[model samples]
Target: MTASRFLDVIVGVVRQHLPAGVSTRDLDGFMDRNRGLMESHIQRQLGGLLARLPGPGSASAEDPELPELWTAAKRTAANLAAMVVAAKLGAERRNPTAQERATLRGYSGWGGLSIEGAASKFPEGFPVPEARGLIHEYYTPSKVAAEIARAVRDLLPTLTGEEGVIHALEPSAGIGRMLSAFSGLGFEDLIWHAAEWSELSGRMLRALYPKLDLYQGPFERWIRERGPNWTGRLHLIVSNPPYGARGAAVAEDPDREYREKRAYAYFLRRALDLLAPSGLGVFLIPSGFLTARTGEMLTLREKVLRRHHLAAAFRLPSVKPGGREALFPGAMLVTDLLFFRARGGELPEVDTADRGILEGSYYREFPRHILGRELGQDAGDDDQTKKPRWGYQVEGEFSRLPRLVERPICAECRITPLLKELDPKLARNLRMGVMRTSLDLDGDALAPISPAPPRSGSAWTATWRSCRPARPRSPPSSGASCTRRCAPG
Candidate 1:
């Protein structure tokens, strides 16, 4: 039977056998009556899908079970069961509690129907469910965790201080994966602080690490209310911040102030704000921060580079089309890791290169045991020279920062030597003298275009108040220098 059909059958059984006004609390009778019917079909579908999937090492483009497909199957069954229970709970006009919602949503379970390994002692473990919308909240895979741990190791030298303990914060601490990683690295006398949005996950994280000062709330509010007290005191910040648009719970005020709508950007801003003089932050966030082409993004980028010293950034592999499933599914956004120190004296030099542990010939060089446990394969020594690996192009103090103001192409740009043409008068006028004056348009200062000859036809097409230039051309010999500026009047 189809997966949806199977779910329908299970839901049908629950609806029919469920007694009138029966609360989800007392579903023992309902579960017992339909246990076989539900588990039979669910297990059959999940098991078949799992069996057909190839092992991780296989490069053959044969029928590979995509991670989304597996996630869909599990989510279908889990959501169907939850809907039925929700119906039962609502039959008595009662809303399910947060704990019930978590259970119903398959959060408190055996890590989303584990097919690779047998259920461990703790069934309700840290397997992040398929992401909900743009909120890409997947659990950090063990391989990625190891990679971050390696970055932390490199960062240890910078953490030298006379203090007896280092203060670290893991905002959005999902089930203590990062915390566990730090502990494994043997960080001595570390004072841990954790913040979580989910009450269920918060409770579980607190239980797991009783020493942590766990704060349960939206990170924005937590940062704002608790920020003043923490200024220049926090030592390190490490997290895989949630990626998505502003959440429903976040008030519009914070977003308006930042003028950026992404949740991760806000987390980054707060992280940089709450750092000690020599503090460090490591985040595995979306690739948009580097590649975004909006004014807001560019402004934020300028702010970050000016304020902080970016130590290293590694560009990890993202899910490609028609490829095997990556560790994070439903996370359509590309991922990268950012290691930067809080703003201090003169932006410290960066080491952005394609030579980190996750980059070049050294990426797949982990211990055989780690590879076996994490990637389900014995490590190979294949040449990775031709292979793509994750690494960052370190930005110098003024390197790679784009000009926010759109300067006219013919004015104040280095590409003037390339555009070989005859009109000496126009070239001299466009140089610096004539185009120096700024014309105010709508209270904003805009420079007038260089009255140069148009490529398409004679005489530039002029409007009442302004004129638009034809699309600029880049010579292939000059390394593809396309003009993003249009002279505004």
Candidate 2:
């Protein structure tokens, strides 16, 4: 049977078991009686369908959509089973109140389906089995993983040279989310290495790409064992390393004293050590790496910034999952794809300069703005001043500040987060603030001036006051200065 036909049959069976005018209370009884048969039947049907499909090598190029559909079906079936179980248990124990049940139902509406379904699909091998029973959890969403992979593709051409095979490594492969991106980038001949700690995930990875070299072990241990061989071997390293900071035991040895450390930092240091000259690395580290205060990070900055140039930083849109509230509460935290070229070689320094202005289409909210402007007829007058400014040059010390502006109002529109919260509709218009002036001065030195008087003879109103001189602040003596001013018109 085709996969589609199997799905239809499963859905049909579920519909038959669903009681008419079924109250939420009846779902548990219905599910308890049918869960086992449904799971067994679906699994058998799916297994048969999969058997008919081509095995990895013999399979004609499988449609990308096929895997997605398979994953979705698996998730849905698993979730339905979990919901039934939870409902049955809730009624049997008489532990949850009606209000609690209602709240659970609401939560189920968004989170329950995915959570239960994910558990069902990978019942034995979740990324972190120790924390499976915890109420809060973390996992990279498929879409976000795909976006990171897309960024890797964007960074590839810059990393590959005219010589040998491209060597890429993903430290925390996590079911090959970023590695899967390689398929889209047309990188079939490259040498790809991934280290995943979870045996289940490793098995999944092997099944997904049977030909690739995958290691099932703690990344740190794998590094210690393979570090020498990888030194100067990797041309590209990308990862969305785990964000846990608690002093937990390393995956390889439970007896070792595993001090508290950011996984990304360890991965960064390892990747740097492994990178070939003129190589590039793209990391999805926590935003805290950019703004946090710690001795380790300071040392890391000194080591990395002094050696490798930072190419670009792209902040992703905040999503509700991944303990985003507790870990990243800065409204939006900036996650970057740091690009670097190894030090001391004939290779030209990596171009860390922002190309948005030269391109004439760079905007922080470029995706939303471009879509709005392109699709809407009432985009109104083009506000050239609000164009995005290149903040920092790749050659300079890595710091949080703007460097160049192609348009006037760019600063106000791009930097101010409040505008979006206050009047989102106005935010869409792209014309609320005064157009900013193009000043050659650094961001910190520029003073904010009120709009010029409508006429020279007009009284100095609050709206047309003199420019406010920026206060002198203590600079990070070791790091680049963080001072930035609103551009003067």
Candidate 1's displacement at residue 386, Å, is 30
Residue 437's lDDT in candidate 1: 38
Candidate 1's TM-score? 0.46
Cα lDDT of model 1 by residue, 50-148, tens digit = 445422211111223322234655644553444444444535455566555443434222233442323232234332333242243465543455446
Regions more than 4 Å wrong, model 2? 1-128, 132-139, 161-163, 246-260, 293-296, 320-334, 344-489
Model 2: lDDT to the true structure: 0.41
239-308 per-residue lDDT for model 2 (tens digits): 7766554233345422132232555666665566466544677776654454333455444454454335
Model 1's C-alpha root-mean-square deviation from the true structure amounts to 24.4
What root-mean-square deviation over C-alphas does model 2 reach? Answer: 24.4
Q: After superposition, how far is residue 54 of candidate 2 from its true place, in Å?
A: 18
Give all TM-scores, in the order shown: 0.46, 0.44
